[model samples]
Target: MRQTSYFHTVIIGAGAAGMMCAARTGQGGKSVALLDHAVKIGEKIRISGGGRCNFTNRNLNGHDGSPYYVSQQPRFVRYALSRYTAQDFMHLLDKYGIAYHEKHKGQMFCDDSAQAVVEMLQNECRLGSVTWYTGCTVESLTALPIAPAGYEQARFGINTDQGLFYCRNLVIATGGLAVPAVGASPFGYEVAKQFGHHIIPPEAALVPLRFEKWAEQGFDTLSGIALPVRISTGSGKQAVVFDEDLLFRHKGLSGPAVLQISSYWQPGRHIMVNLVPDTDLAEVLCRDKVGKKIQLKTALKQLCPVLPERLIDFWLGREPFQAVAGQKWADIPNALLQQLGQSLNHWTVLPTGSDGHKKAEVTRGGVDVKEINPKTMQSKQCEGLYFIGEVMDVTGWLGGYNFQWAWASAVCAAEALRADEHI
Candidate 1:
């Protein structure tokens, strides 16, 4: 092997966390190298939010913890998020004169393009004089001996296609397996395993839900239809609900509501979708059925004015509605009307599977949170070893919560590395 060149910190992955950590660590007067296997850097950010990049959210609830973010140890992220809030990143954006606007639910997106956000992060690294190693794959990683008795921790020797490099601190910000086309890999999880860290089995989050039954039921014909809904998955404490737009796709369901619940949804479990959450269909139908001469289908339109006409027709053609077909609103039995209302309000279905990593906006599970320091993001078992961003078990809601976690965790780890003199 060639002689190993040394640095203060070597971060594997040139994505959000790695780049941000490199900038912070290097700016703090430590030598930093940010490396990635992809030829292009920040492809994830480049394609996020339809190219606008929802960089961060204003609703992080940073004073406590981000309520939208999830982890096995839910409170583990509190410290990092509190230390570096979404407002902190907004200030950074202001410094660069990057114009952004808030969309629904506090999702902030760039007015221009996601490329600008990537460039801004790149410029931040430039200011810190951080080195870049794109298009290079790390062949192997080895834990070196502690530097005599004076050093605080042992260093890491990383073998790469380009050459051998060593660092006092090794940060795995390699992200998760989502968007594999952009060169995502299991390298980070493998590194965690090499050092005795447990990896939580990863699943696709923030992706479309597919169902074979729905496709055969002609629900696929409702593609392009979207309406606000209240969606819930799981039961008891594990249950999660989101009030957002639900979209009908050719295969199954996609949209904010489905994406939000997808993280908590397990295989063989059913999801509850309320087509008309804001209105009590039972109450409306019961009150109006007493004297109305209109048909049941017409009354349904009045009850759910936002629902598409085709979807209303489809629902009217099924089950109880089919039995009461051609009947006037007043002629239909009150019991059947109640049943129809209940069905509309509590529609439940099983998802065969998700769109998987290729279509997943984020990976739900990763390096187990229990194995990392909540404050410093350092491995509990390995000194000078850190995991950040999606590589860790932390997953945020569909909005900008994930990006906020990336920023907060990167800053936390960077600060920890800077405090270590040997690192």
Candidate 2:
């Protein structure tokens, strides 16, 4: 913990991945140092899932990697993915006697409070030989030369207000610039760039969609309305789709489906919604022939339970639905039926923008995976330089997949460092 010219491993973040990596490396008999600039560790996790902390996903177990992850070479995540999977993470929690519950969709969250998870992790690190440094803002990294033995031997030349501390190995676990309040900084990406790691464009993910100007009035009324729907994008390029609940916010749309699909979405594209999935609309119309005399508004309300009754009256009423609704029972206009069915089935809205990094649940892109060794979480381009956590482009779904990546990557790097001797 003293100001040293050098140490074995230098992990530069105190979030989930950094903590996991530090613990693993330290447990391997290597002197590992963890540094963070935040006042509190795991601030993001503390406030996650409405303060319960959606920790990890139970469905994933030792897979080669996941399609959900986006990286320059996504295939590289295999080693970490297998070494420390969702099952392994859950085991750790169980060992700690932490009470958690699976909140639909394999998301494990604390039953009591997010604070419990943070305490458990901090306890784990304490049990190890990890040197903890908090409230230390990393100014820059000056990597020292590596010895012939492959283990880091040079001073990291770390700069902070606390003092100058050095480490043989450097880890960029500084995370991404998502929620700056939790110390989300571009420092990670900047450090990677300094060390010559290719970085992908970064953006906000798992945030609410902003509404377009024209529909603001309609969307305003639907703020609290939420329904089970399949949200998707275009085809050819993989479309984002979720068979989950959708909330119509005053700003725009949100909820599980939007959050899930937001990762795959690109700006300026319409976010498509399947109001009634796996169902035929023509059949619905034919079945409703008996109620043909009913007003157009009443018919539409009957078809889509998600649509507000008031909206139904306004949109599908005599004048509004005239373009889609048939005239009478005998003459159920073919074109009108098809149009109404298609519109209801394939509803879409353009997102003016996202909630941005301020409210984003996670960052989308990061250090390009091609430059790092997926097996070891070490820099393939810059020896002794490693990246973990949101700093890597490998993002997960809205669930706890991201946290799992952090744990897995940390273990991978820790084991690799332990096996190698310091230069």
Candidate 3:
């Protein structure tokens, strides 16, 4: 018979949320056990934000962070986010003397290596006296009999490859299926299902949009070109937009604008792009045609100076523009020039698909937030079972919002578990 160890809490997945929860719970004097299938933890943290790791965003302060998040219950994030703000996480970082700076739009990244952030979390776990269980696969999980009367007893029996462990509280922080290379899995969703909870169908988010005939559209030649543009998708109350840099890839569209809009994009829906967001291309073209005898291409260059020459060449070489390419600006009709302006101002395209989970920064959906308690991050049906971080349906916009969610939700769960100890 295998010897069973008992802990107050057994949290799975030692990534951002699990580690934070363990640290907080252990510091609260609860015995905690942190487990993960990966031998080397925090691989996702190490590679995020080009290795510097955008830990948290300053924008979450003074405002409701739920607006920046996507979920069936977008407002579900309010309680935890309000309880544990970004400032709280920054205070923790300050305690460790981790130097970080805001890169863009209040996105904060470590000044040195992302490894420093990982080390700081590890140290926090140590301070909490949390037990580590790396490279450990859970074989089975069974609910034990509830304690009688006023007796405190282990509520969960988790059998793993290492050994059997019992805990009063079980937290599923296994995260979502985003980057499978970093050990992303659907285990959390599975656990949620087993305990009678609903899961929001997960999809690849914050990934580049891929077109069906990208090369045929002449986008292949413009692979490395990037520019500032306004991108939007959806409409009315559901509409979402982003004013950010757009990058052209051989396969499809990427960069901040595409990634942000991709979160709200559906298969059959169209995305509108303003190529010349800074100026009205049609008005400018018609204005330039008044006196200039210059060729259409030269007039376009002078009108929209911000556009790259390669993109202009590609744009002119394709479609209705091809008929008027060689024609002088003064020779082209105002109707055709207006048509060209509309095309540039409202360039709508349908994306065939996305780059998928392999390239996605985070998974869009997970265990349904409606089935979890917002205040405690605990399951509505199962007592002492908690879900936190990206494992839940709540997903934030690109930047540091997701990390803030992880920190907020983890702290919320920790506080709840600590309160349980006093009960």
lDDT of 2: 0.77
Residue-wise C-alpha lDDT for candidate 3, range 213-320, written one tens digit per residue? 889868899999999999999999878989999999999999999999988999999999999898988888887687777889888888888789999899899878
The TM-score of candidate 3 is: 0.97
Of 2 and 3, which scores higher on lDDT?
Answer: 3
Question: Can you give the lDDT of residue 422 in candidate 3?
Answer: 39
lDDT of 1: 0.89
User: What is the lDDT for 242 in model 1?
Assistant: 91
| Residue clash pairs of candidate 1 | none
Judging by TM-score, tell me the better candidate of 1 and 2.
1
Compared with the true structure, all predictions reach lDDT values of 0.89, 0.77, 0.90
Give the poorly placed runs of model 2, Cα more than 4 Å off: 1-5, 145-152, 214-217, 306-311, 317-319, 322-332
**In candidate 3, how many Å is residue 202 off?**
0.3
- Highest lDDT model number: 3
Candidate 3: how many backbone clashes? 0
Off by over 4 Å in 1: 1-3, 146-154
List TM-score per model, in order.
Answer: 0.96, 0.91, 0.97
